[model samples]
Target: MDTINTDILICGAGAAGLTLAIELARRHVDFMLVDKIDGPFSGSRGKGIQPRTLEIFEAMGVVDRMVAAGGAYPPQRKYRADGGYDEQPSTEGLAPSPAEPYNLPLMLPQYLTEGILRDRLAELGHAPRFGQELTGFEQHADGVTARLARADGTTTTVRARYLVGADGGRSFVRKALAIDFPGESMKMRAMVADLSLTGLDRGAWHRWGDGPGQISLCPLMGTDLFQLQMPVPLEGDIDTSDAALAAVIAARTGRADIALHAVHWRSVYEMSSRLADRYRVGRVFIAGDAAHVHPPTGGQGLNTSVQDAWNLGWKLAAVVDGAPDALLDTYEAERREVAAAMLGLAGKLLEAARTRGDLRRGRETQQLDLGYRTSPLACDARGDDAIVRAGDRAPDAPCRGAAGQPLRLFTLLAAGGWTLLRYEPDGAGVVAPRKGLRIVTVGMDGELRDDGGHLRTAYGFAPGEVALIRPDGYIGALASDERGPALNTYIANSLI
Candidate 1:
C-alpha cells in the first residue's frame, strides 16, 4: 500500500470538510480532503444559509457567487382540504444596516453551496479526492495515521499531524474514535425528493394538509426543480419508488393539473438530533453532522457545521505552524457549547412544528448574535463599555481610504488574516508593525476614515483604541490605548 503524508487529513467532502479545506488551503496549510462518494452530493439537503455563514462566505470570496446563485425565501401558500389556500411568509424580513449587511437568511440549494466551496478550493490548488473513504484511523502522540479504502478494493495509508471527521452522523471516523453520540430518533419518517413539477406558481412554497402528515412543494432557487417533502405513512414501508412518489404527490395535492415530470433524487429519513459526547479525542476531532446533528427544523444544522469548520481551520493552521497546542483545545470548548444550545433550539423548533404548526423562522435563526464572548481567546483589556466586544462578531462600517476610495470593514477583512484597526487620531505615531498583520489607522491621515459615525457608534471605542480582528472576522482582543501591547500579548499567548 502506498503511504501519503500530510499536515491534516480531512474525512468527508460535505460542507464542513470543504469549508475546512478551503480555509486551510487559503492559508497555505498542507492538507488532503477525501470522500467516500464517487461524485458531488446531488440533493438540496440543507437549503437555508444564515447571515453569519454569509459573512464567513464573504471572507472566503464566494459570497458573490452564492448570492447570485440563490434567492430570497418565497412566501408559503398552504392548500386546505376545502380547496381554499392561505398565504404566509416563510421568513421574517429585516432591514440591512451598517453593522449587519446581510440581515436575512438566503435560500440556496446545499449542493450549490458545496460546489462553490469546491471551486474555491480548486482555485487554491487543491481538490477533494472522491471515492476515497477513511475506513479507520490511529492516533499517536505527535500525529495520526488513517486507512483509506476505495471502491476497487484498493487501500492506502495516510499520515497526518491531525485528522478531522467531517463525515455525516454515522461517521466512520467518529465511531472509530469511540465518541459517544447521544440523541433521540423520531418515529415519524419524512420523504423528500427533488423533482420537476408543473402547475405550481413559482412565487411561493406550496403546502398541503396539516397535522403530522403535511406535504410541501418548494421551488428551489437557481434551478427548474421543486423540492417535494411530506410525512411517510407509519403503517407501510416508505416508498422511494418514482411512481409511488409521484402518486403520493398527486394524491396529496388533490390536483390532477400538477404533474410530476421526473424524480431526480429521493430520500427517506427520520428526524433526529444528536451531539457527540466530545468533539475531540487526542489528535482526532469531529465536526459538522458528525459532531452535532440537528432535526433540520430551524436550518441550523448546515450553518452550525460551516461555522465549526471556520473555527477549527484557523486554529489548526496556527498549531501546525508552531502555535500553542492549547489553542486547539478552545475549538471544542467554544463550538461544543454552541452546538449544545443549538440542539435544544432545533428540538424546540421541531416540537413547535408538531404542536403549534408555525414553520416561520425569525431573527434568532439568522445566527448574527452568536459569539464567543466567554471564550478564553477573548482578551478585552480596553476597559471601555462597547456593544461589540472581544469575541463578538466584528461589525462592518462604511469608510474611506487615504486615496479617496470607498471601503467597507468587511472588504478590509476579506484577505483571510489578522487585522489591527488602530483608532489613532491624526495618524502621527511611529509604531512598529507586526508581521502578517495589517495595521490600519482609522482617523485623519490614516489609511481609513469613517465615512459616517457608524464605526464609532458600532465599535464604541474612543480615539487611540485598537481592535484586533481574527481571521474569522471576530474581535479576538482589544486595547483602549493604541500603543498598548495587549493585542500582541493576546496574539502571542493564543495564536502566535
Candidate 2:
C-alpha cells in the first residue's frame, strides 16, 4: 500500500496554489501544491494588481519584492459616465481612504506575479510539486486520498487532512467532488495580447470605446510592450483575421502610428460569469476560478481567488492543529456569499459594457469597494442588526493598537491567531462563549461620517468600541453594548 499524508494537498500550482502553500509554510503546516505546467508561460494573462491585493501581499510578506521587480504606477485612468476616460480619477483618485495607500494600480503581468509568489514560497522553504497532475481523490472518514499522475506517467497517492482545488475553471478536483458550476456564457469575445503597441496612448489603462472597436491598452512591467485587450462583441467576430485585429486597434485609437509585434497569446472566451453552487464538499474545497469563473470585468477574478486561498489556508491549518472541524464551514459560508455577489456584479459590468451606457451608475453605485458586508463572524453589536448587517471582506486601516506603537490593522493580525477589537464598549465584551473561540478587542471611538472614506473609513473608528477582526480579514462578531460575551462566544466557537 502506497500512501503519503500531508496536512493539505492543493491541486493546480498556479497563483492561488502557490499563495496557499506560502501561507501554510508560514504557519509551519506541512502541505504540497501540484500543477501540470512545470514552467512559466510567456503569455500575458492578468496585468492589473489592485491596491487591496498588494496590501494582502504586504501582509503575507511579498509585496516589496514585487514592487521592486515591477514599478509603481502613480496614476490610473477613470472612465467618465459615458464609456470614456478623461479626468474623473485617473491620477486624481488616491484611494481617498486613510487606512490604505490607494495611489496606483501595481502594474505586473500575471506570469511575473506568479514568479514573485513562487519565489516567496521558496523563501519559506517550499517549492511547488510541479508536473504532478491531479487525477482523482477519495475522501475517507479521517483524511482525503488524492491520486496524481506524475511526469513519468506513474500514478501516486497523496493522503491529506484536506484538499483544495486552485486549478482553473476546468478543475479536476471539482469534477471529483461532483459539484455544479452554474452560469451563462455571453458571446462577448476579446483578443488579448501582451506586446509592443504602435499608438496606444501613455496612461495607466487606455480605455477607448468607439464605432469600429474598443480597446484597453495597459502597459506591462519589465517589457517595453503594453498588454492590449481588444474587445469583439458576440454578434460578430469582427477581427477574425490578423489584419482585421490591427485595423480594429487603429480604428479605436484613430492612430495608425502603431507598430505590431508577434502575438504572444490569443484566446476567445465567451465571457460566462459563473459561480459554484458550493465551495466545499466532504474533505474537498474549491477556490479561485474553480469556485467562480466570471468575466474579467472588475479584474476581480484573481483577487477573489487569492482571497479564497487566504481564507481557507489558516482555517485548514487551524483544524489540523486541533481546532474543531466545524471551523472550516465558515470558509464556504463567507466566500461563497462574496463570490455570488461578484457574479451579479460581473453580469452588471458586462451589461454596461455591451449597452455602453451611463458608467456613473456602474462605477459609483456598483461600489466594488464597499459591496462586501455579510458574515455571522461579523455580527452586529446587538444581535439581529449584527447578523443581518453588511457581510464582506474586511477592510484595512491605520491604527494605534493596544500597543501605542505605529501599526497597520493588518500588521496587527497575528500571523496565525485571531484578532479582536472593541469598536464600541457598551456591552460587546460581556458576551459569553457560545463555543470554541479566539478574539481581541481593540477600542474604537464610535463615529459614522460617510460610506465616505476608503478602507479606513469602512472599518475605522475613534476609540472605546470594539472591532473584531478575523484572521482572513473578515469581521467575525463585533459588539458595542456587550463586549465580553460576544468576544468569548465568537472566538471560542472558532477555536474549537
Candidate 3:
C-alpha cells in the first residue's frame, strides 16, 4: 500500500467530477480526481447542454471547443403508424443580448463533452486517474482518509482536506455516509442505445408512437451516430443485445428498409426522482448523481450536475486558500435548494411528457432563471427596484478597458479572481482593495468604460454602485449606500 495527500479528493470522473477538477486545477488547488472506469464514458448518456451550462463552460475556458464540437438541436419529424411523417421546427432561436449570450440550448453527446473537459484539465496539467476505485473513506474533523484500490489488487491511502462523491446514483460514498435518498421509484423504464445506421435521414430527430410506446432516433451532432430511445416494459428481463435492440427499432419504426450497422452501447434505464437527505457530512460531500437523481426530462440531469460542481469548485478553492470553513457549509445550502427545484421541474416535465405528449424544449429548460437570492450569501442592499441583485448571475456587458480596447464583462471577470465593479467614487468607500480581489471602476472616465451605458443597463445599477462578483461569476454582494459596512462585513466573514 502507498500513501498520498491532496487538498481535495474527487471520486468519479463524469461531467461533474471533471468540471470540478478543471476548476480546481485552474485555481492551482491540489486535488486528485479518480474514476473506477479505465477510460472516459462511451455512451451518449446526457446529450443536451443547457444555456446556463454553456455560460459555465465559457467561464471554464472551453466553450469555444464545445460550440465547435456540437450543433443546434435538429428539427423533430413525427411518424405515425400509417407511415405519415410530420416535421416540426427544431427549436426557437433566441437572440443573444449583452446579459445572456448563450440563450439557446446546445446539442452535444455527453461523452464528447466529458472529453473536452478532460482535454482542458490536461491543459491545466492534471489528468483524472482512471481505473482507481474508492473502496472506502473515513472523515475526521480536519480531513478525510480515502482508500482506493486498483484492479490488480494494489491499494493506496489518500488523505485530503475534503472528499467529493461525484459518483453515480448508486453511489458507495452516499451509502457509506448513510444518507437517505428519499423519492419515488419510477415504474416506467426505457431502452436506449447508440448505433450507426443506414437508410434513415440524418437531418431531423425522428419519432414514432405515443406515451409509453414512444420511440425516437435523434442524430448525434459532430459524429456519424444516432441515439435510439424507446419506452420499455417494467416487467420481465430486458434484452440489451444488439440484435434485440435492432429488432425493437425495426418493429417500432414499422420499416424493414432501415439497417442497424453498428451498435456502440446499449442499456435499459430505470429512473428515480430522488434527492439525498444531505449533500454533506462533515468533510465529505456528494455532488451530481450522488446528491440527486432525475428522469431524462428537460435535459436537467447532466446540466444540473455540472452546475453543482461549478458552484462547489470555487468555494472549495477559496476555503483552501484561507477563507472560513463555514463557507463550505454554504455549498449544501445553495445547491441543495437548486437540486430540489430541478427535481420538481424535471418531474413536471416527465409527467407532461407522459400525459400530454409534449417533447419540445422550452425556455424553462435553459436553466438561466436559477438564482441564489434566498441564500445567506446573497446580501443585496440595492432594493427590489433593480432587475439584477446579489445571488443573481453576473451578467455580461460590452465595455472598454483602460487602454480604450474593447472588452466584455465576462472577459474581465475571467482574470481568475473576485471582481469589484465600482461605478465611480461615490461607492468608493466600500472598496477594501484586498489580495485576490480586483477593483475595476467602470464609467466615463473610469478604468473600464461602459460602451453605450450597457453595463449600467444590464447590471441595473446607477453610478456609485459597487457590485462584488464572485469567482464563479455570481454577484456575492452589492452596495447602494456609500457608508454601509455590509460590504466589508460580507468580505470579512465570507470571503476574507
Judged by TM-score, which candidate is best? 3
lDDT of each structure?
A: 0.87, 0.67, 0.88
TM-scores for every predicted model? 0.96, 0.81, 0.97
Model 3, span 404-493: residue lDDT tens = 898999898876688988886553455567878888887767789887788888887777878989888889998875456888788777
Q: Rank order by TM-score, top first?
A: 3, 1, 2
TM-score of 1: 0.96
Residues 342-375, candidate 1: write the lDDT tens digits: 9998888878876666789898888888889889
lDDT for residue 386 in candidate 2, whole number 0-100? 37
**Lowest lDDT 10-mer window, candidate 1?**
425-434
RMSD of each: 1.7, 5.4, 1.4
Looking at candidate 3, the ten consecutive residues that score lowest on lDDT are 424-433
Model 2 residue 324 lDDT? 80
